[model samples]
Structure formats: C-alpha cells, structure tokens
Target: MELRWNPILETWVMVSAQRQRRPFMPKESCPFCPGSGKVPDQYDVYLYPNDFPHLMKDPPEPSIQDDDLLRVERAFGSCDVVLYSPDHTASITQLSREHLARLFELWRDHYRAMRERADVKYVLIFENKGDIIGVTIPHPHGQIYSYPYIPARPAKELDSARRYWESHGGACLFCAVLQKELAFEKRLIWTNEHFVAFLPSYADYPNEAHIYPRRHCGSLLDMSKAEAEDFMDGLQRQVRIYDSLFGFELPFMMGFHQEPVDGAEYPYFHFHVEFYPLHRSRDKIKYNAGSETSGGAFTNPSSPEENAEELRKINAEL
Candidate 1:
C-alpha cells in the first residue's frame, strides 16, 4: 500500500491492493470473540493492531515509480482496532457505563501514543456499525488511524476555524455555532453537563446528529474528569437514541474531530463528534448518487427540524 497525490482534489489517496482481499461477512469464526487466538481470553476493552492496515510505520518501496504529475510517497501511518467487548453480538447501547469508560480511555491512550510519534500528524477515532454501513465484523469495536498528514475533512475544519478566529478577533467558530444551535433549540437532541448533541441546520444527512463539547477545547485531553465522564454518557445516549429511532440498531459512521498533533497550536479548533447515519428511515437508506458523488454536493431530501424532533423525543423518552 502507498499514498498517491490527488492533485485535482489536493488530497492524498490510499492505494491498497490488500484491503480487497479482506474477509467479508464471515460465517464460521470471529477473531474478536473469546477462545480465538487473536485476543486474550479475559478482557473488557482491548486494543488490537489492525491485521490489514493500509499504512505502516516503515512501509516498503512503492511498486510504481513516481512521476512529476503523479507524486507518490510511503504511507507512513498506523491503524488500531479498539474492541469494545468480547461478546460477539454486543452493541454500543449494550455495553455497561464502566465498560464504555474503559473503551473511551483505551481510545485516549492510543491517541496519546500516536501523538508522540514523529511520523504521525493526525489521530482519528471512528466507528462503523451495522451491516448497512459495510461492517465486515459484527463484533462491536471502533478504530483509530494515525495519518502522516491531516485528513481533508479535519483540514478544512481547521482552515475555517482559523479564518473565523482571525476575522472575528480570536473568536471560535465552533463555539459560535453551538451558541446558535442552543438558542434555536429546534435541532437539539440532548445536552448534559459538559456536552450537547444537535442536528445542524445545514445537515447533509436526513437524520444527522453531532456531539460537541460545551467548553471550547482542542482535544479530549483538555476535558476534565467530570467532562470526560459526561462525554461518555452522551456517547452511550446517542447510540441508544439511534437504536430507538428505528426500533433497531441503526447503522452509522461516527468520527471524532480534534486538534492535529503535529506539535502546533490549534486553539481555534474545537473537539466534536459527527455522526452520518446511512438509513434515513425504516427500511430506507440515503444514497449518494449524481450530485453527492460526481458534483461533490450533498442533498438532504427530508427536513432537518422534523428529523431532529424525532430523535429528541426518543432521547427524552429513554
């Protein structure tokens, strides 16, 4: 595997010939379950190295030569899997509060390790759940990827935050967004002592929701002990909200965006979690055709207010 420069989009694309060979929905055995050689027999939350990682610490030479137009480079990075539980059928909502706390700390530990690496620039914590989200393993788990450079989405967010900070006399953009959303109160799902979950007015998905720290901070390390505990509560509640929305465990792509760990200051950047659920409603999925894929513009057919209300009601009931 190697990284190829996409000049048009001004991004690096991972070219991996190995990922295609990964197992599909396996029928017989699961490496994450107990009694499997892949993991220990006893553990609540565990960190396992990805068996098939796209990037590595010391990558081999690229098979294809680099050209002036097609700039190629070694994919210097790391990917780790954070197993939430050994139970083969456990979901986020099923995990205990103490277990969830341990899982969050496991993610924090990996992030700190990757931050100290000289080759790493950004650390991303994310999870893909449900078969609709193309989850190869049904076992509940999340993954962390340390990239050699800041990813496109996080880079764009940083740029925007920096611009806002400069123009608004060192004011934070994300804080302003949270203030606006809180004032409106139409898109809000829930707000704990330290965090808030809401659907942005300009949500790209029909039922999209976001979790943001109430206090402006660069990363999870900035969170206090109480703040961190509340954050975990918000996470567990969010998953429960999604599961109760459709009366089933909903499939979604979740990612946490924070400050880049390139030994640079990012005070303007704020910590937040963005969730992109694949299904819009019961037995229906929102597909990215034409405008979303070709034109790079997302179109949400449903009303954000209505969708947010649905989740808010379910969240309150639970």
Candidate 2:
C-alpha cells in the first residue's frame, strides 16, 4: 500500500494491491450480520474497521524507489465501515428517520475523531448501494475514509469556491448555486424546513440529485439538532424517490462534500450531499464510457428539468 504521484494530473494515486484479494461473502455467510461473529452480538448501528482497506496507519514502503519522474510515499490513512442495521434485509429507505439521524451522528463523531489527526487532510463519508454499484455485501452500510491528502474532486470544488469568494468580496459559490436552484424551482424534487433536494442545472447524469442545507454551513458539525433531523428527512426522501422510480431498488453512489479538516480557513465552502444513480431511466442504465472515463467529459442525454420533474411527481405521490 503506497501513494504514487501522478505528475501529469498532479494527484496522489493509491496503490493497494491488497484490495484485489478481498473475499466476497454471500448473505448466508455475511460478516455484517448480528450473529456473523465479525461484529457485536447485538447493536442498532455498528462501526467495523475495513478488513481490506486501501489506506492504513502503517503501510509498507513503496514498491519502486523514488525517481525524477516517479515519486512514491507511504499510504497513511484509515478506512472503516458503518453498518446501518443488524437485520440483514433493511435498506436505508426502510430504516426509520430516527435511525438515520443516529447514523448521521456517528458520521459526525467519526469525522471529528479523524480531524484530530495531524496527518489527516480530508474525511469522506459515502455509501454504495445495490450489486450493480460494486457492493458485494448485500447488507446496508456506509464507509468512511480518512485521506492523507484531499481528493481531486473536492479539491477542485474548494479551489473554485475560494476563487469565487476572493473575487466576489467573500461571497459563497455554493450558496449562490443553492439560490439559483431555488429561483428556477423546476429542478427541485423535495424540501424540508432546513434542506432541499434538487438536480443541478449542470448535472452530468440523468437522475443525479443533490441535497443542500438552506442555511450556510461548512460541515456536519455545524448542523443544529433541527437541521440534523431535517437533513436525514431529506436523505430518506431522496432514496425513497430512487426506489420508486422504476419499481425496483435503484443502484446509486452517495457522498458528502464538505470543507477540508486541514485546520485552514474555508468560509466559502458549503456542505452538500451528491447522489449519482446508475439508472438513466426505468429501462436504461447509464454507464461511464469513452466520454466520461477517458476524456473526463460527462454527457447527459436528458435535461435536468425533465429528470427533476419525474422525481417531483414521485415525491408528490410519496
């Protein structure tokens, strides 16, 4: 496990061959179950260290020595899995709102724990659902990764937000985005008192949705008790819409975007959750092919308004 520097792209690529040897366990032998002997005998929610983590506290030296072009360093970080329920069949949508709020609290505490580490630069909380999304474990759960350095996508967002702040007299770029979405209103799917779920106008996927806090906040720690409850409500509704979209469990990738924990100032940064579902429609699946993977260009065949309207109709029924 080591970090290889990509000079052309200016990013650190994690090289962990151990992940290739991960064991795939079926539901009958699932380790995340209550009686599986891998976790506590009984618990509402559990936190288990990843058996095959991409990063760790003590990693071996790099495979190849450092050269003028190729730079290498140890992969020093941690990854852990947050099991949502001991019952093997309960999805996030089925979990009560109170349970989801507890999950959110667990994420916040874990983020705070990782932030205390001087080497940790970013803490990412994300979930992958459905077998098509590469989740072999059928159990409902999420994962947290503490990175030694900020990942590329979040770094780009921070850079853009910072530039916008500096140029616009400390105006926040994300807040501006939320306001624009609210003004358009066509892309909004659902909303509570404290949060809004909408498809961005610049969406790259057909059903891509984002949840943003109505009040400007940098991280989960900034959420009040009311905001926390409302956030979970928004999240649950978002997934409910996903499942109802095609009368089947839809596969999707959900991630939290927040300010870095490097102890620097990022007043312009905002907290949001982005969902990238693999389904383009009830019958079609959206795959990242040549344009997306090779050239970094995401092509959306459908308009965000039409897509959001579809979800809004579902929201109305729910």
Q: List lDDT for all candidates, in order.
A: 0.90, 0.91
Per-residue accuracy of model 2 over 1-318 as CA lDDT, tens digit each:
889999999999998888898877865799998777899998888889999987888878888898878889988889999999988889888888778888988999999988898878999999999888889798889999999999999999999999999999999999999999999999999988999999999998888999999999999999999999999888888999999999998999999998888999889999999999988888888999999999999999899999999999999999
Each model's backbone clash number: 0, 0
lDDT of 1 by residue, 74-189 (tens): 99998889899998878778877788788878888788888899999999999998787778988889998999999999999999999999999999999999999999999999
Which clashing pairs does model 1 show? none
RMSD of each: 0.9, 0.9
Q: Each model's TM-score?
A: 0.98, 0.98
